[model samples]
Target: MKNVSTREPGLHKGVLYAMLAAALFGASTPFAKVFVGQVAPVSLAGVLYLGSGVGLLACFLVRALVQRGQVGQPVALTKPDLPWLAGAIAAGGVAGPVLLMVGLSMMPASSASLLLNMEGVLTAMLAWFVCKENFDRRIFIGMLLIVAAGALLSWEQVPVLGVPWGAFAILGACLCWAIDNNLTRKVSASDPLQIAMVKGLVAGIVNIAIALAFGYALPGAGTALAAGAVGFCGYGLSLVMFVLALRHLGTARTGAYFSAAPFVGAAISLIMLAEAPGATFWIAAALMGGGIWLHLTESHGHEHEHEAMEHLHAHSHDGHHQHEHDFEWDGSEPHAHPHQHVPQRHAHPHYPDIHHRHRH
Candidate 1:
């Protein structure tokens, strides 16, 4: 049996990576907004996604070449894995970005920024339902407050957009991302770089085809360069970091950490573009902060148990192999016990002793 230990340093590294990804994602919003004026939504979406795909592919190819000996190795992708990959491409890579682009084109930056917060709420809910992740009542309530705060912050802009169909597009994006979050959890056992590359390539090609069919004009040199840079940062590097973090943090915690991106974007908009959100925006920000506090500070103290068994390999009196069993307890309270080993068809003990410990 293998002994598992809590590695605080690894958790810290995961948090740092997650936070950096969130920061990059947030900073990309303003840049994406800038390109909306110079290029059509569909075309912009295509260029951004495709560029991101190309960038990640390049990085992945280099890594693969460096580790060429490991190439063509058999991967255990069962029938269950395909649906998850498909769902991830559809939600996170395809639908989410398309909706976000369309909505940004039709609405105020501030409003769209707040609406993007919906991704967090949607993601958390999906993680809870689909992944059966543990979430206490306080976490749910905090999530609710965060959503309400976002609504409050963007309330004024809602009237300005005035029931535009494009707003629905943004909601679609959130739904796609929610689906993507759940799907990511399913495929997280795979290599993170490989997963990112596959998602980027598949989604990029599909988005580009859609963009071309929509009659969006190709942008000139300057806009193209800017869009490409934004794509690299927002989609490429950001996604790599996100996948790496997901491996350690899981979906729900990743979503909660990502919830800070919009606020970071909002701050960038204010500083770089001089776009100021009104009083309600600040109030919403406060609510989100409180929600974040609740999320980070609270912990559910649940006990987990692991079973370990030690057996002696010897011929048994029951015409089978016989063994002695030893049990060890490793948890908040320490105790030891011993049990008899019974051999059926196999020589090993049927039941093993379990060790219990708390996870951070």
Candidate 2:
């Protein structure tokens, strides 16, 4: 029996990336709320996406120039990846932001930010049921707590409408994002910058075009620029980190770490919007905090199989990568290349990372 019991090398990096992505995304919610009334929802969404697209495009260009002809460069997207990328863009890029903007217009930023936690629960559900990712009681219980918190956060005493339509819209946004998260996982092995950049540009352009056709007036230059800057950090960089996390953490776990985003958003909302938290907010916060803790503490280890396969991604000479290179390669620690995996079996702590997607 192989006795190589160690934590997956990517675990810490994945967690950090996931949390940073959460912080950027969470902070974006309140900032977006700042523009709620100044610009039309659809138009604001368009501006934000456009900003991310434009910003990332510049970054992509610079990185390409700097890394020109680098041998170990990240793999580019291929034909088969297009469908997954397109689906992710449509769900997350086009629909998610629009719904979030509309919801922000109707509710407090803090409340809207907290409500976005529903995305984690939804993402986990899809990962477990549809994508067949493994899970345990801890994950299930954590998801339940998050779901309960979302319900409590959204609940209102309105006689005619039990819940505010704003809550529904935000929840709808969460669903779209959940779908996007899963779809993006299908192409997580590609260059994350390219993936994020394409998503930003396509989604941004489509949203802006739709908004213009629908007669929504564009915001002033200052407002547009502000929205764009927010998008670059919140949407563009955050998404790049998110895709990186997905490669190491898988969809559900990444979503769990990313769930912390709402807390960051809620805190920013309080400071920026001067919103006072009521008992509901505190209770929901506690519940969400507990749920995140559960996920963070999770660990899984067992003898799992790795089937023979061929793919490309950035990796170092870890246990999973024991193949010989055919080229006279400079000995770089982490590099990307087309490689093949020989079937193997062993036991160690693991996530549903790129190389460890066997059915449990």
Model 1 Cα lDDT, one tens digit per residue, 29-82: 888988777877777777777777777778777876775654233233345667
Give per-model TM-scores.
0.72, 0.89
lDDT of 2: 0.85
* Candidate achieving the largest TM-score: 2
Cα RMSD, each candidate = 10.2, 3.0
Off by over 4 Å in 2: 5-11, 97-117, 146-172, 273-282
Tens-digit per-residue lDDT, 1-360, candidate 2:
564554654437788889899899988977887898898878888888889989999999999999898777878999999999999999998889888878877877667755776888889989999999988999778767656665566565432323599989989999999999999999999999999999989998999998899899999999899999999999999999999999988999888878767667767777876889889888988888888778777888898888899998888877888899988889986898889999888899887888877898
* Clash pairs (backbone) in predicted model 1: 306-355, 307-354, 308-353
Q: Local distance difference test, per candidate?
A: 0.65, 0.85
